[model samples]
Target: MNEAVDEAGWDVEPGDEIEPLVQAVGKLLKVCREAAGLRVAELGEVLGYGEDMIRKMERGARIPRPEYLDRADQVLNAQGHLRAFMKDVERARYPRKVRELAELEGRAVEMLLYSHHNIHGLLQTPEYARALFEMHQPAYAPSEVERGVVARAARKSVFEREPAPTLSFVQEQVTLERPHGGKMVLRRQLEYLLEVGQLRNVVLQVMPTDREEHAGVQGLIEVLKFADGTAIGRSDGAFNGRPVSSPRDLRILELRYGMIRAQALTPRESLAFIERQLGEL
Candidate 1:
């Protein structure tokens, strides 16, 4: 393996659900390399990967990046066979919980989000998200942080769905002032928020720190309602923090979120507030 590969922050989570799929793909990769009469080192040289990475990927011990599959298809003449796994591998690269949340977001026609200390994942810019992940308590490895950034970014597709969903966001005022990724990153994030806030189906609000009675004092809250009349919700201070789908449980979350919205600045005022913040930067 190349020196960089040895140090690269890529590792497959033990007992992950993606283990079987990765292993299967890896075995095929090995077969393809052998069929093409390429030694592991030779393959590594062409693919710009270290032998260790190549071997790990081939053993299904690592999730291959899409670029790896694409390049491998061309190098080994697999005729797109290897490329077919890109989507699966991409999904495998993230934790299953992130993917599950993304799936729920995709199916929802209405989403209500509240943030306590940071921007919601769907609203965060890639750079901002990267900075946030880089600040994790244990300090995520470069590869792990990259995975988080990609996963967060993928959730943004909700904004462009053919039938646009109603997206209501309430952010704590401190989230706007805190420079999570330095001043430049915060500036860009505010700019992006302004752009998104202007979308027809979006309602963005800010909850001020001075508010005497805050509904969101409980913490972050999220509720997504689908076209089929089914809805799911989760809150930091409710139900032991697990997601709830029953009408009764959802009612509790909705009640809290409704109050949060009522307590926040109106959408128009919020945009003006963001613009003012940006000007100060």
Candidate 2:
């Protein structure tokens, strides 16, 4: 067991506190496997994972992906117990801040965004996200970069929710041109933007660099409106740069976002512009 633990990368002391939810999931996996009379190695073979990985997952030293829970539920005949824990497992994979943001995003009924720099997180490709995290000022470790990439990709789940949220984005032309992760990465990103733009619930516009009068010159702005009539906003132009939820502040941000959307190229035109960029690439 000690050798297996070391192989699974459990660098912490034995008494370290594991996340409660993760521990709960591990217990559930163990109970189900035992109840089904399946040994760890047998279950690992059934799931196409190594015995050490299964043991680590059972010990709460590692988090399993959602699909893993589904398969475990089937193989262990735990009915829906394992599958029911998928949401908790998924949440445990992300950092605290990302989990909070994703919660807010999940509850949002609508999102309005103006990006003067990089593409919005929800719109970024995995390669693009990995590259961006790798280029962080202090430089992220490989594991940190992978985690960031997964977290960002997880935010796209909003697009898959029932009665999908209304999303509107205005991206600066210069942002599309700047190869943050080099030309090929940018090309795939632009292509992805075009794909996401075509979704019925999404409105994507491009703020042309040639425009002299830009409403969003102040900087990136994001407004998320919830189903309960409350909203939250953040912007580079805001005095303290903190997220604001006051109705007055939300209204002010909405007004600016509205103007930016109006001034930018229409969705159809934006798609054409992106296509042109792809051709140039």
Which structure among the candidates has the greatest TM-score? Answer: 1
Please, what are the lDDT tens digits per residue for candidate 2 over residues 1-281? 33322222222224433366677888899999999999998987777778878877887877777778898899999999999988876677777778879999999999998888888899999989988898998987666677789899999999999989999999999889989889999999998998899999999999999888888978989999999889899999985778999988888899999999988999999999999999999
lDDT of 2 at 28: 95
Which residue pairs show backbone clashes in model 2?
none
Query: Which residue segments of model 1 deviate by more than 4 Å?
Result: 1-9
For candidate 1, give the lDDT: 0.90
Q: TM-score of predicted model 2?
A: 0.78
User: Can you write out model 1's per-residue Cα lDDT over 217-252, one digit (the tens) per residue?
Assistant: 889899999999999999999999999999999999
Looking at model 2, which ten-residue stretch has the lowest summed lDDT?
4-13
Candidate 2 positional error at 202, Å: 1.5
